[model samples]
Each structure stands twice: as structure tokens, then as C-alpha cells.
Target: MSLWYFLIDWFAGVPTFGVLFKRFMINFAWVCIALFVMLVFQLPAEYAAIVYFGFIVVNGVMGFVFLRQRMQMRD
Candidate 1:
């Protein structure tokens, strides 16, 4: 299914909390794996922090988009 549809459905309570949490953990697992590899390779601390910061920014944008979509649907 489309990304927008998936997010909208999740926000609308179509999926149970367990399912959503599981999905989040699964996706986050990959991010953790990538970070681990970067650490193992001895990447510079400043670069590593930038990667983490990017993740935080993306997460904030996703939250904003989800909230905006939900609000639009309400109107």
C-alpha cells in the first residue's frame, strides 16, 4: 500500500498498538544496525553525531506529517 495510506490508517486506529510498536521496532532495528557498523568502523565522532541528528530531524518531520494528515482528515 501507499505510504500515506499506511500512515493515515495507523493514525486512524486501524492497527493495534502492538502491531504498530512491532513495526517501529523492526524499522528502528535497521537504524541501530547501521549505527553499529559506523561505530565499528571508527567513524569520527562528529560525523556519527550528525547521522544521529539526521534521524531526529526525520522523526520530527514524520510526526508533523502524521499529525497534519490526521487533522486534515478531521475537517
Candidate 2:
């Protein structure tokens, strides 16, 4: 990668992963809120498990996507 590419957060003149990170963070925050709500409301164990698994799945997907993008950019 060029110095400019290393110092900047764009790819081919377009904004890079900041947007994707922001979106993922927002969704993560919502998942956290939902988990907190479930706890506060004493929701069923099954419901809590579902939400927790959903969070795990989302995290896994986001990590995969980020790594894929990074690999693509490296080339």
C-alpha cells in the first residue's frame, strides 16, 4: 500500500471501513440494549439465549467481513 493509502481511510477514492464499522457498532449497541432489557425484564431463559446467540452470530459475521475487506484492500 502507498503512504497515502496507509495514512488515509479510503479505497479507490471512496470512504473505507469507517462506515461499515459505524454500522456494525450501532447494531452491536442495539443488541446490548436488547440483552440488558431482557435481563431487567426477567425474560425467559430461552429468549435470553436466543439474543445472546444472535449477538455471537453478528460478531462472527462482522469479523469475517472486516477481515475479507482488509484482505481485498491489501491486494
Candidate 3:
């Protein structure tokens, strides 16, 4: 409904605002987690960003592995 929300929905091709809201929540959670770790551990905040970015890639691999393992178990 709002301008920025409209732009995001249009750009993402999502028909409902709920979908956009869900995606934003997930992304924001990851960012919060990264920043929290950085602050609590006294590590460089940049590495937190780097690690969060890496989460995208490693998540795919882990998902694939879990899927494959489940498929194999069914046989």
C-alpha cells in the first residue's frame, strides 16, 4: 500500500504484501543475528556481514544434503 512497499512488491513480482513481509522478516532476522554475534563476541563486525552473506550459499548445500539423505532413507 505504501510507496516503498509497492516498489518492493513490484520488483519482486509478489502479488500479496504478506509474501513480501515474510521475506523481509527472514532477511531482517539474519541481519540481527549477525550483528548480535559481532557485538557479543567482540569480533570485527565486517566478518559478521561476511558470514551472513555466506549463509546464503551454505544453506543451499545443507538443504541439498538433507534432501538427498531423506530420499535415500525412503528407498
Candidate 4:
């Protein structure tokens, strides 16, 4: 998807963005989905999105920690 490309481009050293925006963009799909349901499906999407984003953050943190340990072990 285009959003994924944007994230990769930003990760590959776009000068304008830093880690915070990168993380937010990584999770942007959920925000967009939440918006769509509110507009189209007539559902309460916000609370579910908050939970989804929380899960995403937790997964990202765990992945980062796992990768860091792997690199340290390799060294």
C-alpha cells in the first residue's frame, strides 16, 4: 500500500520526519479504518481503535526489544 511506502521512505532517511511520526504513520491504518466506519458503517469506531493502537504499540515495543537482544547476542 502507499502508506507502507511512505513509512519506508521516511525510515530510509527523509529529513523531515522523526521516530514519533513514523510510529504514528505505522499505526495510521487503524485511525483511517476507525474514521471510515464512523462515516459509512455508523459504528462506534473510536474505542475499538484506541484498543487496537494500544495493541500495536505493545507489539512494536516487544519486537524492538526482541530485535535489540538478537543484535546484542550476535555481537
Please, what is the whole-model Cα lDDT of each candidate in the order they appear?
A: 0.64, 0.69, 0.62, 0.58
TM-score per candidate: 0.63, 0.57, 0.40, 0.41
Please, what are the lDDT tens digits per residue for candidate 4 over residues 1-75?
Answer: 699896455334323225545555756666667666766866676766676777577546645655565567679
lDDT of 1 at 44: 87
Best by lDDT: 2
The sequence of per-residue lDDT tens digits that candidate 2 reaches over residues 1-75 is: 888875243223223567666756776798889988988999898997888788778666766666777778789
Better of 3 and 4 by TM-score: 4
lDDT of 4: 0.58
The per-candidate count of clashes, in order, stands at 0, 0, 0, 0
Show the colliding residue pairs in model 1.
Answer: none
Write model 3 residue lDDT over 1-75, tens digit each, in one string.
799996444344433446545655666687788778788989986787687776665445444554565567679
Runs of candidate 1 exceeding 4 Å displacement: 1-27
lDDT at 60, model 1 = 58
| Winning candidate number (TM-score) | 1
Query: Which ten-residue region of model 3 has the weakest summed lDDT?
Result: 7-16
Name the better of 2 and 4 by TM-score: 2
